[model samples]
Target: MTTTRHPDARPSVSDPTGPPGAGRRVVAELLDLALLALPLTVGALLVDTLADADGGGQTDRVVFGGTAVLIALGILVWNRGHREGHTGASLGKHWTGLITRDRDTGHPVGTRRALLRRGTDVVTTRTAAHDHFTPLPPDTGVAALRRRRLLGLAALTVLLMLVLLASVAVGARPMSFAEVYHALIVNDGAETDIIVHSLRIPRTLLALLVGIALGVAGALIQGHTRNPLADAGLLGINAGAAFLVVLSIYLFGLSTPAQYLWFAFAGALTASVVVFGFASIGGGKSNPLSLALAGAAVAFFLQAMTQTIVLLDQTSLDGYRFWVVGSVAGRGMEVLWQVLPFLLAGTVVALASTPALNVLSLGEDVARSLGTNIVATRVVGIAALTVLTGAATAACGPIAFVGLIVPHIARAVTGPDYRWLVPYAGLLGGVLLVLADVVGRIVVRPGELQVGIVLALIGAPFFIALVRRRKLVSL
Candidate 1:
């Protein structure tokens, strides 16, 4: 934890400076996100628009096939984002006009330190449509950054409101902005008000909340462990959760989403405990790779147990599909609300660890000298990570690549400050997931694909790029 931050820190004022290559990377990231969104968005709208009320066969093909396509596109972008984000934010930083200057030293950002900037940008500057990020004149570098960050934040806020408000206006059924606004303000259910209240508004809010929560959790876990390759399922949380669900179904005969959810959460927590116990073993303690391997081993063992239990009777498989596939469909606002306490508490815990994380990046000896309690931080971080990821996995069935990927992107955008990184990662994750979910809705003509599949498709290439970069760039 050799890193340091300025509480009074402010963005630099300038014309969002960057290296020559930064523009290309920014364009690439934008293109990737857009490409993934485009096909899925169009496909969903197309399928929903064209599908027969009777759910025709042709519509099914279009929706399902499109969903597959959407997944592939999402993967492409996600993979690219990870690569670009992690490789020192190269072209993306330059082009985005965001610079990752060191916080304590007040100089250009070092490799790991860059994540801090991204975190701040993602969280405060990039989240929700707020007027917070007001740009200063370009003559001052810090002022400019602050302004850009603020602008970025404000722009994002407006963009999000517009996108969601627009969706409410024009979804399975369409509404004008005025009409939707009127419904909201009046709080009355006119013919139009019913559609506004029931379908688009709730779903839109749900999307934002889910996306933010998932994205933040993903970032937190990846950064906490410093493993770009790790996913929520890395430690077999899903397998464990699934086993519990299987038990609930075959032995207990409880198949409802609400009933099974608790069992799954319990299983996830149990798996996390086991995984961490193994990781904390040995003389020095487990690093990223060691922890991942341990998780994978635990997951495999649990999955075997689940399979064995299910073999006794075929009745358990029915509950497995819907839970295992990881969907945002058919869930109520209450479920979202129920999981939020865990999410909020976990988020706070994770955010509190940022400063220590920065110091740890400098090497253990340095971090220790700088007054960091490596042991305490690790234990707390793990606990927080376990809860956040486990809750998300248990609630949503192991959404993939997010924890692994979003932090990389966050790192690229901001810098290595965990403070900035956590929020940015979370916001980015939210945006990405919500958008992906939307795409899944339209891609298959009428059928939908799972976000997990889409993230995998997008992330596999990114995983390759990460390996390649780590191979090429040593520390």
Candidate 2:
């Protein structure tokens, strides 16, 4: 028997065996990486420009440039709407030529169709999700799936965009719509640039990256575990990373944020393994609910231990508070680089599992008959999840809803196909966090809400709704 796959440049629904082409995926990723890296690179260049400069000039320049990029991203996102959602996106979609089109007529696409397409995509993706990792209601109606997906997408876009725009406007030196517009486009060295760079841009970008990582990681983990509730932080990776910092402070007396890296990485990896083992322990297959429970258990256990540690040592407590609460503030390029390798590697592995996840969705007997390597698939998925969650928690100190909420958002747009779901989730995730973080910056006038806090405040209701869901679906 010969194995076949989709061409990486363009994914064909008909072809399921080929690796996704690099060009489409890579270009978009590179663009995002550049966004993350550019701020610091520019800041460094500015510092170099004025070696004899005091902190004030360097600060102003760094802040200004960073803010410009943030505004660009926000405006870019706003303009990215094809009625809604990304089209010809990722590096590969450009090369392989992927475009969102009218589902039925299959024409060049208009805003209404794009919106409808997004609506369907989310339904298909989420409904399929119901069947794959966790079971939806017995004989869950197609119509229900469609509605959920549409509602999810609508909720996300409305919330994310409003928050982002408001955040941009809300700042220490508040600017009217005109000034903000001038800073974003004209870019004549003014206080407007400072507003754009220092607060709005960098924070938004950081939130974007963090959200993307978390959203993709959530999809991977959820798809892998088959548990709708499974989140990157829920799996104990967040606590592990935080605990590592706690350990470092308690033992080594480490102080700088830079010093938190190794410990965070170590913590993330360790937690993943422990959680995996817990999920897989029973003789039966590791269901999504079991995995989620395992993760929740581990997370609570670690958090309790951490709180105890904090209660004992104020120094450790001081270090842990900001990180545990989850914020995108004060995160510079250094933090981005330090955790980037893990995020990239993890995302690759997760993306790699989409085919297997698709097969798994067909159920165990079918998967085995088709030679899907269920055990191996599980291993790869778990590993991918570990790497992704580890890196994300390490980077952003356990930002939550991006992972939990973004997949649902992606599903609303792309449907339940893991193939499209994974990538779109990443984009939607980026958009979500950027909006959230941006809002955090502006909501309370300069003091900032902190991305984590904002998400929790928002995510709390969603999470509660999920928990309150009366119908428990079993596959």
Candidate 3:
């Protein structure tokens, strides 16, 4: 008989012909579980402390405890899928020098298979541990990916310019291309010039700014957490802004967009800080699982409070409804001016962090080995996300799905590189929002739908298609 040794083989006395024994697997899992639990424990303590400081009763403590537990479970779920899916190695497995591979092909498994394996292990606890797998094709080279990204950016830029023109041209009042050009260039004193300068131009600019901010924010949130489903709306940012806008209307009778803009911005910033703080309890670094769970918990809590207040007062609801629906209309250059600095700063931060994000995506161990400062990267990323999301929400009343959908579309075109993804996402986001605004204007004629409503209509179907196709987790 002849024996062959693989290049990466490690000898095991107990399992001479196979993988690691069940005992080793269990021990590795226990270690990983302990590591995962550390942050949850810290989060629980912090939540308890905050509750006590706020003079919260037993009920509040219980609520916080329950939320902490839910977050822990969410973290477990996220970790199981993410750690095993991407590298075929959980933190414990990696530490134990045990790597999972396809049983049939003896190759690394993709994210879907890893998730399935974890799911099966949960459901059929006593079943024989076996897996069947197929090998993945070779990866595309970096140069090829870059070329594709460049092409995508070029295409998206063209689309965005067309949409910007359309946004300026098609509105409650229509104007010809010639009139639009003349108004923009010649500064003619015609009715076209008044509409273009006074109404369409400002709103269009606002749309572009809001779109860029939301898109980049969404990308940052998703990349930082390594969660494909992450979005500003899902993370309580939009709900937070909505809650404050509602509060301002009910308490202070703030009617104009300008009056509630600062309130909305403050609310957004607060929500982000709370979410980050909760996620960073023990580790000081934001884990993907913690971020998602914290965001969800905050979002649900704020949304409930907002709904309760709106239901209690009809006048507040009437005012809140408009803001909650999220439109770029009725905004002028002043609104743009107010948010431009924050948005610009956020955008610059996002672009600057792309390289760090790229490194961070390669798992913490790899990132650390490559000399990446994981904590600093996460802090910068979160700051960018907060500023961008807050500015956009303040300006546009929390437009949905621009952040969620645009990045996915950009990713499909640009692959997983953040350098290309950020710019592409920003451009695509502007295009999508402006296009949605134009469609909303046209579909209802003089009675236009808000951009948020239009996006929900468009984004829902696209999201459904993405899930059905199982492409949502491509990142």
Candidate 4:
């Protein structure tokens, strides 16, 4: 039982028992197949859930579907991609104490190599007898990781508060701290009172909600799809919502955000269903690739339809252009109240799903073996994602980048753990959005850029840098 040591990394444990027997390998492969089939089984159930629901249960449907999608995908990626790449073992391999190692250096195979080997090994069972295996690392750094994540969350919360203060204090019309305080507590009906109470407060609150929603939504999207580049829009929520808003303007002469809010929400929820349905078309299973492709196609089609309508109707064109710019400005408490329930529901579901997500990220077989309900967990994930993204998009017209970029920032701090990543992303998102809105107000005094535009301006450069700096991996 000689251990092969690596100076640069963890050493591999040698087994005098030689390689795993053919029966073990066969069982492992079968387990892997079951894991792969889990998604399809869940997708089939999801379709049934959708078909049986009534119109009144639209929100419920969206919530369940989105939540389940994320959980399902998270499990798939963790089991198949991250687990094998980072540790040198898949679920089956872990069970059988099998591992892929460098043929030359006798080192653990990295992600790229692990993935390549997965394909080759499937075709041919032949493995070198010299191959060594290691069990999953113990939960050594968990406490440290939890402590760090908690600290990061606290820091983000504080930053969010500061940004909220800035959002309230600094706007097109600057109010001194005392004046702002007076407006809230005193309410003497002065100019500052009207500005603070009527304008900045609601706008700031809306931004806060939108930020948290987009941020968490982004994190969930990345987790579910296992795509580093995936964002809230990957599910077609934004485009679907925007398209309906425009359509409402064109056909019904709806001019206000409140008027179209429901329509947008409906569109978003509908789009999520459509994406899932399309993904589940073949063999009644929805994979991440199928979901992504379907989402993209649906989003593009909806956008094109929206454009055609906007171009044809002058009234719609005017209303659509402004609404599409994505601003929390001019929206009142009523708008916030309307979307608050969905946001709250989504947030709760998302947070609750994180523990299951953590388990799912380990692998389906492991999760099942540990008593995690694969179907229910995934349904909850997909549902949470739909509600969050739909509410955010409905509240503020498809703000880009917040969902696309905030998760990456959160992931960098929290590592691959979704438990911390989702909350951190939400807090960071609120801070960034409120901060961006404040910057927009100050930079162009007497006028302000919409929050959506500001986010795009900031997000585009930062995203480009993120891409240049690192590889995109779905945590």
Highest lDDT against the true fold, candidate:
3
Worst lDDT run of 10 residues, candidate 2, spans: 120-129
User: What TM-score does prediction 4 earn?
Assistant: 0.69
401-427 per-residue lDDT for model 1 (tens digits): 677677777666555667777777777
Worst 10 residues of 3 by lDDT: 119-128
Q: Which stretches of candidate 4 lie over 4 Å from their true place?
A: 1-140, 368-371
31-136 per-residue lDDT for model 4 (tens digits):
8768867765765464354443222123223433444565566666767666776666678876776665555655555566665664324211224333444424
Worst-scoring 10-residue span by lDDT in model 4: 52-61
Query: Which of the two, 1 or 2, has more TM-score?
Result: 1
Tell me the deviation in Å of residue 298 in model 2. Answer: 3.0
lDDT of 3: 0.78
Query: After aligning candidate 3 to the native by TM-score, how far in Å is the CA of 324 from where it should be?
Result: 0.3
**Model 2 per-residue lDDT tens digits across residues 1-475:** 9976545555456533233345644564465455456555664564454332322233333344455566555534433333224332322233333333334432334344443445322212222223332211222477766565566557556656655555565455546567777777887879887767665666565666667778888888777666676678667888888888898887887776668867887998998788778887976566666667888898898888888888999899888876777777777667777777777887888888898898887788899999898878888887887787777677778787778877776765656678868877876877767766655654454366877889888898988887788963221
Q: Report lDDT (CA) for all predictions.
A: 0.63, 0.66, 0.78, 0.77
Q: Cα deviation in Å at residue 417, candidate 4?
A: 1.5
The per-prediction tally of clashing pairs is: 60, 30, 0, 18
Residue 223: error of model 2 in Å?
Answer: 1.7
Report the lDDT of model 4 for residue 171.
60
Task: Please give the range of 10 consecutive residues that has the lowest summed lDDT in model 1.
Answer: 120-129
